[model samples]
Target: MTSLSVLNSALLVLSVALVLLHVSATRAKPNKARTLFAIFCGSIAFLMCKQLSAASIGPYQFLIGIGASATCNAYWLFSRVFFRRRDAIKPQHLYVAVAIALLVAMNQIYMFLKGMAVFTPAPDALVRYILVELTLLLSSCILVLTFWEGCRGFGKDTFEGKAQRILFLSVFVFALAGSKIAKGLLADNPQALEYIISAITLLVMVSTQILLMWRYTNHLDFLTTIPLRERLQPSAATDATKATDSRGELSPLARQIRDLIIGQAQYLQENLKVSDIARELDAPEYLISKAIRTELGAANFNQYVNTLRIAHAQTLLADPDHLKTSILAIGLDSGFASVGPFTRAFKTKTGLTPSEYRQNLQAK
Candidate 1:
């Protein structure tokens, strides 16, 4: 095999392993973000395998195009799941991905039936133009979403935040590099550039996997690059096996969680994330999330954290000594990022703006 094919084969092997590992690992479960990430990674593996066997299997350019489309859809879905809580990979998401793949396939299927061969340029081919434009459009959207997630998550100190930054970097590199590769293929110039792009892709993927493991291990504090399945997964002995009755009654775990947040006031930490709390309790992030949502009456992690902040602010406002404190100061002290978000959250919880709530407090 050529050196390029050898490289492709190596990457293909690694990507396949990643897919299998991600799928079988129970620890990553109950986390839709991780599942979508696996899908994203798996799509990369498919493309790599296709490239590694391109000589024998033919370019299968249309199938490759479908894989590209699937990657885009997976990235978009992962982005949504990463940033939003309680959200999931909706059926429509799968439908859209399937639809895109079918559309691309149909274009090629028609050409093949008409006696057109693969990798032969039909400069005026409407199918080719349409596919190229679609690729560019998806690249643009992915770039936008990556940047959006990056900016919003900048300065986050939690594990999930670190993962977000890693994701942003990977996607940014992918989009930047993928755009160039798209252009090269679309123009059919410098075929060697495709090989180079594939190499770059290999590096990016490997580095991302390294970073993910590094961050996760560091956050968990005993994990090396490879953690034991039990250490990572924690099995059903955790919250997954807990009965509804066990959760409903303020269980010891639930009470300890409550005291940690309410009594110790961990919510005041501005950079707190569910994963951070999970590490603190030595429990799965989802377990902590479930406890807070089911037993503690939180709609989600953010809502739970924000409610605590607002409640703390209310307590501070009601203190006679703190009436002299400005609402902004109270908001900041309450762990809100700024006055605007604080005011909005305050109103959301109390049905009155900060200033109005303070005035009513004064009147009382």
Candidate 2:
């Protein structure tokens, strides 16, 4: 291997290790979506390792080939369940996996009996490559469709459907890498193309590792479930005050409500129920509700709570430090249990999807 290839391969191995560690760590948690995400990471790690080592073709390749095929298929299945997509748990899906695994295992046994270590690259390789690519494309389409549907609802603002987007993007990169590998399998100049494909794939794998870590751990503290650092600095408050103060008329009660909501967010977590805030401030529930209504220009108590949640969620989303975090999980932890309401509030406030907002943050 050339120095560059060695370096790239080493990096790929490191990425695989990181992902595996993340999967192990998250395994104990009963979070279905997160656990599925961990499995997705593991599958990618296995695929990358196979590419790096160049699976011995034939029986070994056959086994590895089946694993590789199943890994990609599993990713789509996992995504459906993770994203709450329907028909994910149907009998047909389970049967398909079992049938594929059986066939692949049978092929491996047959080749081994023939005293072959690897199967020769036969006409089947072409058919398998096309099928795998088509499957990946189908998965991509499903992801895109889910994201689009999620966007149509207010839930897009919350971290709800963003997983689909991230998963799709990761899959897209993998598919592109697979395309290069497929080309190598079919055409001349396989060696150089293999290295280039490996390099690009290494980049994608590294990005996936970073995102998985960020989503599951507080490696970047700013991406923590609870807001730790102050966002919308105190100066932002002063600005809001400045605008209101210029009129030489500030409603003390309304100002108090605003300060309480914004201040509680800055320090304490999202435990501020309207009644709790009302009791702490020694105000009537109705009066406190009135103050929030008039001051924040929002309707009802739940809307007020969601406003605060969305505000905090935005702060996390906007933070350059949290670009890797899961927007949906962040939304949930931010106190918006559902993505629809979160996305609506987010779009209403920021006029962009969580992914778009993150992209904008990255652009900056």
Q: Report the number of the highest-lDDT candidate.
A: 1
Compared with the true structure, all predictions reach lDDT values of 0.59, 0.52
Residue-wise lDDT of candidate 2 within 202-287, one digit each (tens)? 55445544544443343223322222212322322333333443444337776556544443232123344677667656898998
At residue 158, what lDDT does model 1 achieve?
Answer: 36
> Residue 291 of model 1: what lDDT?
82
- Backbone clash pairs for candidate 1 read none
TM-score against native, each model: 0.50, 0.43
Instruction: State, as a TM-score between 0 and 1, how close model 2 is to the true structure.
Output: 0.43
* Model 1, runs deviating above 4 Å: 1-30, 59-68, 86-104, 107-124, 153-167, 170-195, 207-364
Candidate 2 global lDDT: 0.52
